[model samples]
Target: MINFSLFVATVLIWGTTWIAIAWQIGPIGIVLSVFYRFALAFVVFIIGLAALGRLSLPSQWRFVVLQALCLFSFNFLCFYKATSLMPSGLVSVIFSLATIFNAINARLIFGERVQSRTVLAGIIGALGLVLLFWHDVTVSLDLDVVQGIGWAALGTMFFSLGNMMSRKNTAHGVTPVIANAWGMGIGALVLLGVASLSGADFILPNTQSYILALLYLSVIGSVVGFSTYLIMVARLGSDKAAYATVLFPIVALALSTIYEGYEWYGTSFAGLGLTILGNLVMFSRIKPA
Candidate 1:
């Protein structure tokens, strides 16, 4: 039941985050918006942890810092930049590949056994994504689109690394909430430093809607979402937990259809079906030899 809840939470929250990110794009640059969003989330999370008397610093601060930089700072920056270049639906489809990446990385780093089902699922999922977005890919000749695909792929790789690092920390008995709070704090500082050096504006928006959106992202998306996801990873293993990314894109596509009037061709549905089937295959536990 905990696993089911975590899966639902991750899919629902992350699926909606793409839309929230889209909302943030008009007035501020992507870097600045990402910086502010994370910074605010960090502050809020720390304060809440402190108030609850649950905050504890990591023993291996340097490792934690590296994880933060990779997971929170660079990963998010790449995601936003990718969205800037490609359609949100396409970016979500690209992110669905994270499950495959996590499986391979887990096998290599943690000596976890890889199932043939996982490889097969990953291949099917990739084919689904290609089929679903072939029209969008064909219509664009812009260099930005190519660059976006590259950035999204890199972002997914970073996310896989972060997952492995989190699993390592979990093995050492570090709580997910504590690790995430510190990680977010470190990531926020790094992003803020970059914004400062680049002379990016740090001014807060006056609009109530923008303020509300920021708050929602900080509290629900970052703090709750990260904590729940890490906990899930610790309990269920990285390969299984990463199934959330594969499934969440379908939620994003659904939301896009409702809110953004996103048009779905036959290929999009085919892609969605294939992606889900692949994830089911990838996450299925095989019998022991």
Candidate 2:
């Protein structure tokens, strides 16, 4: 039940994070916003861990660092860049491919079994994504947008690697909270260094709304979302927990309908049906060995 709740929380929070990202567009640059989001979240996490006496470094420092880089730094950078160049909905559709990437990579790297049902579900979900965002995809594709899709794909790949790494660390008995806090800290430092190198301005938004958005993103989106997700992965296993990705875009699309005033087209509804069906097939608890 706790695992189920974690999965639901992860999907709901991350689904709405796209809206939050949209709010971050004006005033702050993307890189700077990414840096601030993670850095602030890291600080808050560290303080919380200290208060709870739960903070500890991983035994395999190098692997932890690599996980941080892949999960936090590179993945986010690519995702942000992808959104910058393309529509959020389109970017999200591409991001849905993470399940496919994860399945393949897990099979190759971790000797995880690749079930036929999982593969079929992944394909159905991909098709659903396409249908859901068909309108957005039908729009003229600029060079930048094309490049953005590529980056988004790369980000998904990095994310899959991070998932595998997290599973590995969990097998070694490291608590997800401890691993996440340290990984986020390292990722924050790396992003900060990049910001410094790029001479990115780090001005705080004076508006109450902007400040509130930043706080929500840092605390709720980054820290809470990430920690809960890692915990879910630890409890549910990577494949099961990763179903959140399938559910997230659906939430995002729902939010879009309300906030962005997006109309629900027929294709969109069909896509939603297919996506849910695919997830059901993939996570049906049937072993595919």
Candidate 3:
């Protein structure tokens, strides 16, 4: 039940982040914006944990630093770039590939076995994603589209590596919440350094929308979403935790219908059906590795 709750919460929160991320794309450098988001998340999350008497440090700094880099910083840099070049929802489709990445990375990094069921689920989910975004898939395949897909794929790989790091941190007695809080702090510093070295301007955003997006990204998306997600990674294993991302499109469909005026097609409904089937396969008694 706890895992279920975390899955739902992570999906719902991240589902809405697409719009917030879109709102964040103007004027500010992607690195600077990511820095601000994590900086704020770090301050708020650390203070809350401290006030609750729950803040704690890990046994070592190396894995936490790696988590900060892969999960919080470089991943978002690639994702934000992808969103700048294409629809944010399309990025979710690519992000769904994280399931496969996590499985492969686990096998390579931890000497874990790769289950056939995991591979089947990923194949089904990938087909679904291709159907769901078929319009974009069948488009001209221009440079921007290629770049967007590449960045999103690269980001997903980084995120999968981060999941492995999170699992390693958990093995070292670091709870997900503590790992997330510290990761956000270190991630913010990393982003700030990159932004500074790139000569990105530090101008404040004047729009109300940008402020609201920043708040949503910092509080709900970074703090609550990542905390729950990493907990799932710890408890369910990174393969299962990564599979939760396949549900993101369902939430995206609902939100996009209301806001983005996304029209549903026959293929999209079919895609959603396949996606749900993939989820069922993943969570069923299939003896996952």
Candidate 4:
């Protein structure tokens, strides 16, 4: 039940983050925005963990640093940029491919053989995403569209790689809570360096919406969302933890329908059903004959 809650919470938090991210896009530099996000999230972690008396650094820092780069900094940098270059739906579809990326990287790095069911579920999920976003997705071979695909795809891979690192750290007895707290700090530092090098301003946005979005992104989205997600990565394999990537966009579209007046076509319902079926297939415990 707790694990299930973590999955659902991660999906709900990250799913709605799309709007907060949208509010953040124009006010601050992408690098700085991501920097601010981790920076703030790190502070929240410090306060919460300190209150709970669990604020020590991990004994091993190297792998955690790699996790920070992939999960916290670089992937977010790519994802932030991709929104400008491509349809957000396309980006979501690309992100849904993380199950496959994680599966491949898991086999390569951890020697875990890919299960046939997982492969089938991943394919189903990917197809579902294509249909779910069919209205907004385009096949334009234009430069921006191509670039967006590249950025989103790369970001998803980075995220999958981060999952591998988290699995490794978990095996080494570093809990996700500790690993991610340190990771957000390191990621913030990395982003700060990049932003400073790029000559971006350090000033906070004056807009109320941006400030609200930043707080939500930092405190809720980053802190709560990553905590739940990495906790799942530690408790479950990253392969299963990553299944959230395939589901969250459905929540995003549902929110869009409610708040943004987004219309859902017949294909959208079919896609949603297919996505749920894929989830069932991915998590089913029936042994293969």
Q: Which residues of candidate 2, in runs, are more than 4 Å off?
A: 86-90, 139-148, 285-289
TM-score of each: 0.93, 0.89, 0.91, 0.88
**Which candidate should be chosen as best, given TM-score against the real structure?**
1
Q: What would the per-residue lDDT of candidate 3 be over residues 1-289, giving only the tens digit for each residue?
A: 8888998899889888987887899768899999999999999998999999998887788899999999999999999999888767767767877877888899999998878877787788778867766665575455676688789989989999999999999888888888889999999999999988999889879899999999999999999999988998988888778767777866766766776566677887887778667655766785665
Query: How does residue 267 of candidate 1 score in lDDT?
Result: 82
lDDT of 3 at 69: 97
Q: Model 3, 115: alpha-carbon shift in Å?
A: 1.0
lDDT (C-alpha, whole model) for all candidates: 0.80, 0.78, 0.84, 0.82
Candidate 1 RMSD computed on C-alpha atoms after optimal superposition onto the true structure: 1.9
lDDT of 2 at 141: 40
Of the two candidates 1 and 3, the one with more favorable lDDT, higher being better, is 3
Worst 10 residues of 2 by lDDT: 133-142
Candidate ranking under TM-score, highest first, comes to 1, 3, 2, 4
Residue 75, candidate 1: how far off, in angstroms?
0.4
User: Model 2, 1-289: lDDT tens per residue?
Assistant: 8888898899888887776766666777777878788888889999999999887877776667777888878898888787667556555656666667778888998887888987788889778866765655575445776677688889889988888888878877777787788888898899889888999888877877667777898899889998898898888777777788777877776666676665677887897778677766777877775
In candidate 1, which residue ranges exceed 4 Å CA deviation?
A: 139-143, 285-289
Note the residue pairs that clash in candidate 3. none
* Candidate 1 TM-score over all chains jointly: 0.93
lDDT of 2 at 31: 74
Total clashing residue pairs per candidate?
Answer: 0, 0, 0, 0
